[model samples]
Target: MASLSQLIAKPATFSVSTPRTSSGQYRPRRATVQCASSRGGERSEPDAPKHQDRRDPRRARRQCHRHPDVRASRRRRPRRDARRLLLRRRGPSAERQRATCCPPPSSAPAVDFTPPDAASLPLRTRPAAHSVTADYVAKFNAGIAAMKALPPDDPRSFSAQASVHCAYCDGSYSPEGFPGVELQVHNSWLFFPFHRCYLYFFERILGSLVGDPSFAMPFWNWDAPDGMRLPAMYADQSSQLYDPRRDGRHGTPKLIDLDYSGTEPRFTDKQQVDHNLRVMYRQMVSLSPTPSLFFGSAYRAGDDPNQGPGPLENVPHGPVHVWCGDPKQPAREDMGNFYSAGNDPLFYAHHANIDRMWSVWKGIDARRHTDLTDPDWLDASFLFYDETPQLVRIRVRDVLDTGSLRYQYQDVPLPWTAARPTVTRRADSLLAPAAQAAAAAARKAGDFPITLDEATSVTVKRPVAGKRSKAEKASEEEVLVIDGIEVDRDVAAKFDVFVNAEDHGAVGSGGRELAGSFVNVPHRHGHGRGRGRGHGKNGGGIKTKLRLALNEQLEDLKAEDDESVVVTLVPRQGKGKVKIGGVKIELMH
Candidate 1:
């Protein structure tokens, strides 16, 4: 046997090129995920009660899952591969695999998931119902033309008359028209939903501009080595869209993998959906404080940082190709970078993944989807225009009904009772409650780090949270500026919190800091038809007593009827301990 490096240099080319599998064959490709993989550092599952048996059933699932790929290769590699060819002939997706990359033998592209290549999947020639066609650039130009035609301040200004609001508002504005900036949701957690909505509209605009009703948003998966180049728009360096860069490596517009080591490979934008869906498959049932705490960052917690998902909570699971951007003058953007809502085209695809994760999570555990009916929690209402272009008042309830309006995502695998969620043997039961309080609390911490279920992996440069004074208000934009505005940037990276700066980090209080940790509660998934909230027992039914330390004061938070009690973080300037929210007042203020 030659050395490892030598083997790679002279790797043998297959004699038959793996015998062309026909179209419609389910070719399992290597998992390609986008945005952080949904299994995103496990958070505590919604408090699954402990089993006295001291034996974890999840161990059984992992033992069972042992994907057909690993096992087949071990048991009978050649025969199993040959069988795949036969299955392809019988499958419905034989023709579509030409372009898709590196499908795993087991995680094959399913007949259902594959779309007919552009040739077979012709553009509906019958005049598009609306203006946008498949070409986003065309639609963009048209929108510019249309916008120019409209008179100034014609509700169309702001590109579509959008009203940005504090997403963390728990419905305080239901009675008062607008909450005037109800800001308890911590500025740190605000950006995720805001940009999510922003991207939603951008996609609509892109679609409208191109005249293709079926166009979807793309993503910026920078983890892969090939993704380092600048998107086409930025590549030219001639446009105002350029961003400064360093030498040939760091700023070369290439997607940088947080895990520089060569383990789990990164993916392409097109491939990451299913990869993420799988991770989301687990997350749908599992709960973690990561999404709420880190927003779009990576999440983890462990004895060895590298032993788990590492610090990059928003770990890039896919390739670097920009679905859209200034490619020529490449400069990659963080998932939670200085991304303002209105700009950025691929923003929609990024959020599409977020939305999909939401759907997956809801399906896995219905209870996980419901907001804690805590008076403060329910009082939040985020403002967003409906597809009809009317600013409809929405709350956590509104977000729950993703299918209620005009959109639905592409048909992806929806984990049914058959494909039960696995309780990873590697999970720490201790993190469940902490994870629960995390979800309940940081439902809005934009980029703050939470105890990632995988291990305590944190995203860097988190946003901050803090209150604003009445005098500091009046001049700012909305209710967040009313109650308290988020500082909007990583507190660790950019510590400036003054109100007058042109680029104020939106996450207030120097980024949201949650006071919860994960702990085991009850096993809910795969139990029965599942409750309206989850697959097992009701979330409201669980007696979740969370031990939270608001500043220095410690208190145990219990789950109310579909309500989450807000352990509001009150950060005062200068280091001083003070009592404001929650009981047991002696907290680390």
Candidate 2:
């Protein structure tokens, strides 16, 4: 019988050919082949060269397409939209293309979880970063030391626990039935669920080793002003929780920038705190009003990870990782890189806060209080070793309710609740009553829609309504409204949207033309029925909308008289392609 690995290695199909030259010498001509599973049956031009040992099972497995049968079916079926096909072939574009008709293999039933009796399993409330007492800190330290002292081979040991992250995220483990594909948890809808489960087991192990079932991991509440800096408890050099490989400049007392992307302009303490609060407001309340936007792109079984990142994951998530990583190290060792992020004890605390935000967002409104209903999302599963050293599989649906996991975050004030955009009173005064009424009416009507699926610059010409007079142009309230932004699948890709920018490369935080940006959070494809604001049309993907108050930006560009304004879509960190279903330039009252 074949070994487990061999059995899991599915056969990949390829066509073979050998054409002889006219001369005595023989020149072989290879048939062009396409991998059916690669980005929705898109053709892979120029087939690879033939190998000598074609009969070798290992070689065949390596060379075979992920879904050869699907490719055959695609050839038999009619072609799809030429524009969408062209967009896919051109690489990452914002166009929404149809997925392959070949449906993914049915997943196993959702993982089962029988919650222990409330009285038997004590609930643990994670303390706030600023409020943890000295005794609580001591216990936390003791738990870390105990975890580190365990035998290296033990699954609960510090090294073993960290390896779980590397294996799942760093491409060390292949999905159980898909050997050629690596299992990745980041950059998709799985970001929240996977990390939540990981933290669940890690916290359990820590608590078990410390002999305190009620012990809860403290969260690094970077969203709040007081919790911006590294928690004081973790900064002690001698403590087991202290990881030496952290950003040297990020020690306590230095205000943490929530929008940190390597370099940030120095701001006064008060200024930085205000900025952090505004960012929180934008991420939690303003931008993410739906499950798809809040949780990110949906990742289904057998798909590649990192399709897109949710808003929270994009901002504080990736930036926090970059900020915590040691600058001197090549791979940013502990906290910066994906493979080694879990090595830093701080990673858990960081994720705990991310988990906390999910709970908090759910309470914000009725529409936000649910998870995606797609079976591919709900049934998605991952394996992890529990405290008993027995490997266990968990599903996304299992952890939807944090209370079921027997842990909750300590209650804290949400300052972003009152946070508001700091528009100057003078700019506010420019809006005439007639213009304001018109803007409100236009918003309700949903006009001026445009679709974008590529990284290109588009100029929106001001609508020529009988040629606007100078006074009319000055009084007109214009807003760059990006609505119904959706993606075809789960991915962690984001693009920086700019206005009237000369060079995309030169634009940065301080760049004058930088208007705003959007992250295409990961969501599952073919599951487009979303609940809440800016929901996508049925048969489309998950959608969200953004309205950039661009009065000041346009004034800076001196573009009031210009016939059109140029908007550039530049991807951040070279993430994959995404699609924008609709955009509109609204000349509000």
Candidate 3:
């Protein structure tokens, strides 16, 4: 019945030992800190607990009774009938719901098309920013100019193309059956599919305008060290590719921080590159080994569109947006704000990289080559105007394979796959006897398992005076290890973790109190085999630990003598649940 903080207050005795590796180096085996807990707070010391099988009929029935969305899905009937029922349930909001229940008057021509044969269509290769040739640059500039020259009303025109992003993302439209609910597509499962289709049509429009069916959109390859700078082609003031409303501070020579929130840190170019590569490895290779983790949570019919973003979307996708937007401008217009993001010419190029990641993710292994099988996910539809100025209804099922869409990206080296952070200092040397004792005591503290359903903060009070050493005081760095993060295998939930954040909403707005994020990689049923070799036999839900290097975050909190440190978890979107079994802090030497 003791709280984690209370347990930490009463120190527990422990010892540390140094082990040697085959390389004749002293490898410190970190003491095993067992802090596992079951649903009823029963303690367990197993190495790793097996996640609950989602395919179990009993578990499904239990979840169905507990979750409102699951219950609604079970009772779902025909679309028309469901709309009527949803509207009636709106009560006083019924009048507003009627507009969405009825179809809008269509003025745009309908699109009729056949899926193009992959072999027959020309493959438009999007080259990386660093590898783009002078000839390719010329073509890209020409294509942009031609698109810009088109009339404002033309769907292929630059203005019209930008408006498409504004309309859908900025709440210009609502779901057909849910009138009062705004259709916000940024933070949900729709993030990937919707943007994929948008870029597909936009690329086609550019090709048509340039009179070259093979003209491909260039991608801003920010993942690699060489491609970290904003592509030089877009910075040319005289070129059509140039956008005047970008962050002046983020011009050429400034490296892109994949984990950028808002503030700039003092990291050497090499350090920044190494950090970026490590982040890429974590997001693409380690964290995301399944479709649900890669693509994000599902947003089906009659559901809200904020059900969490995948790792790719949450990280580089969002940070890149904030990094590019002019900080001086109100709301960071152009690339920063959702409604005006596409207005910037570089937006398409930036998204081209995001789209390229999807292709690269699929090619990583055979098990990851599949898409979501849920009928609601597969059949989810969005409206967009294609090259012909004809409104087309694109389904999630239509764009699963990029090859079928008649485009591809230039193959590039994935340096992050082999990137592993090396420990320069010996653990014993870094942790003095006193520090070691403190760490062991902290580990013995009872685990605190908190379920995140909404914005919540937990405060842990621990005296800091006696815990500090000369090295710790000089470095002011520590490691925060969170163990046993478990989420439902079927739900793609993600939450941003923050320490000492006064306002949860402002956590990632360039605040110094921001900690890392916890992204869930959900289980895929009937996949025969799992995507990554790490999954092994146990593959039901996201159950893993996070070791965050919190030197900077802790320094920002100035909690050296503070009695309590508040940790906050903010869900990216919609409703999803996650449970954390324990938290530990160790000195990082």
Candidate 4:
């Protein structure tokens, strides 16, 4: 395999349609995102075939599978106003899309024929410049040096005090912006790259402060049913860290409060919508809770603070694994307008995982990875920060050439590499007695650990769940393909859409649904309080689950490959405004 230097130095190809930098090279295709307030034009198209399918099969099977009687289920506990993110769940009619996996009478291959594993492929290795550990340290120093160069009132300085400004409002940030774009660099495509960039800087600062350059990022995925507690880095009592139940009054992370064991997920109009900002208002803004005396104004749910219901209360763990994002983080609102690569702190690592998840998705249901050829969805563009920290724009086409990029993550074995999905094995005794008792209750209700693929057959000894409004059961199998990527049919199995703005990791809806919503409410008027109840600052707290789907339909990705199978996925949604940096997920529940 070519070295990392070759990947970074690979020349970017472009046409008038695909934007290129002043250097006139497609180096890292990033665009200077212009908000609704800026001059806008549809992006230039590329010369490659609209759709390209290059999924790695080894990873797909991990998405999920059933042994024989496995069931698909979701419980609609009580609906709290906040959890009403991105509207409601809509899918094809239960006829084909529901959780049942019994195949209809057909002669289709029981499983698609597998091409022999591509003959031995070369391994990807990096030289000193492309090294993850090395770059991490260098970038850390660069950020610190840059931070020191900024004035006291500069935004970077404000970050030191956890005083992020409202990217929209000229004032301090709110996790969500108020009226204008947050930082020029913030936007939808930028979410991952930006945060990864932020984390690079943040990690360096932390490393510099503590004398530990090797401190890896503490991912919060430890909350699975089996690994359901904060990782030891944050939750160890001996560490003497800040407890959520104790010092939890901040609209910020504590000095070292990486623990996210808030017990249950946050629900309620104010709590749910606070950070998961939407794009309905003049601009999206972060509504994360604060140490202040009161939660602010809202038409719904927000009590008079002086009156009933109190100031936006939190119903913790009402449901777990939920979160919204900071509008300042990109990838939240739209993929077409920004660069997502360089913005995220965990960009490389996170995508490594997401890419891994895609492999897992197709592995679970080989057919689910086919792209439904659709048009509008195919021509999307996103932004990213390059290895040089220069914001460059990219398209779905650009991502296909992963080897040409500067970063490639360390190899981590997939969860489903085993014959049968071990899923996640935990010592049953690891739970606190209370949690253990709770697990028993959940088990009785068939809500214990679940491997989500609908193909998997397992017994759910309990009565299955539902609030199925006939229409609620999606039957029409409309397929959506965006750029060249196919949303695995089982996207929903791995993710749960939520309301906060700063919460990243969940899938953002693609365009079709938003277009539908636009067709429904042609005017840009308010639609009540949206999912956030009356307290949401704008749009509604909206974020997609890690499930394999987009928010819309695309009929544009059919290449001349008879070996490829066409699959459908639901894309994430986007209203008319800019919701930048919604991609930066500070914390996810």
Index of the highest-TM-score prediction: 2
Candidate with best lDDT: 2
The full ranking of all candidates by TM-score, starting with the best, is: 2, 3, 1, 4
After superposition, candidate 4 runs with Cα above 4 Å error = 1-355, 371-375, 404-589
- Candidate 3 achieves a global lDDT of 0.54
Candidate 2 lDDT by residue in tens digits, 1-589: 1111110111121111111000000012112221222232233212333222423435333433221010000011132222211101111122312211111111121123455457866888998777899999899999889888986545577876775565345432222222233334665677888788889888888788888888899999898887989998879998888999999888988888776645654788888888778777756765465566567665543344344556687676776777787868655657776656777989898899999998998888865346777555665655455665544556677889889988888888898777744433233322556423433332121232434444556555555433455566445546565555555423344566666555556443234465556643233221111211122343223444545545545555555556656666665532444555455577643
- lDDT of every model, 2 decimals: 0.24, 0.55, 0.54, 0.21
Model 2: how far is 3 from its true place, Å?
28
* Candidate 1, 408-468: lDDT as tens digits: 4444434322322222212232136654444443323243322112211211111123332
- RMSD of candidates 1 onward, in order: 26.3, 14.3, 19.6, 23.2
User: Over the stretch 1-589, how does candidate 3's per-residue lDDT look in tens digits?
Assistant: 1111100000000100111000000011111111110111121122322233323446433221110000011113233321111110111122222111111112322343345675645877878877888888888788888877877545567766775565445433222233233344555667887788889888888887777878788889898888999889988899888888888988888998877656685778887888788777656754455576567665543444345566687677777887887767655667876656777989998888998888788878766445777655665555566665555656677888887788878888889777643323232331356533433333132546766667655555443544466555445435555666665433445566666544556333234455667543222121111111112133323345554545434444555555455566677532446776777665432
Candidate 1 residue-pair clash tally: 148
What is the alpha-carbon lDDT of model 4 when measured against the actual structure? 0.21
Query: Residues 1-589, candidate 4, lDDT per residue (tens digit)?
Result: 1111100000111111221111011111211111111112222122322222212223212211110000001112232232111112112232312111111111111121111122322222211112335445454444444544545333233122121111110100110101111111121222222233333333334434434444343332211221223223223233322123222232222111111122223434332232122211101001111111011111111111111110111111101111211223221211111121112222222223333332223344344332212221122232222222233333333333224332333443332222111112122321346533433332221232322222111111211122223232222222111111111111111111221111112313221112111000001111111221212244232221111111111111111111211221212222122111111111111
Q: Which ten residues in a row have the lowest lDDT in candidate 1?
A: 4-13
* Residue 136, candidate 3: C-alpha displacement in angstroms: 2.2
Worst 10 residues of 3 by lDDT: 6-15
- Model 1 vs. true fold: TM: 0.33
TM-score (all chains, Cα) for each model: 0.33, 0.62, 0.61, 0.28
Candidate 2 Cα lDDT to native: 0.55
Off by over 4 Å in 3: 1-109, 118-120, 176-179, 421-515, 518-589
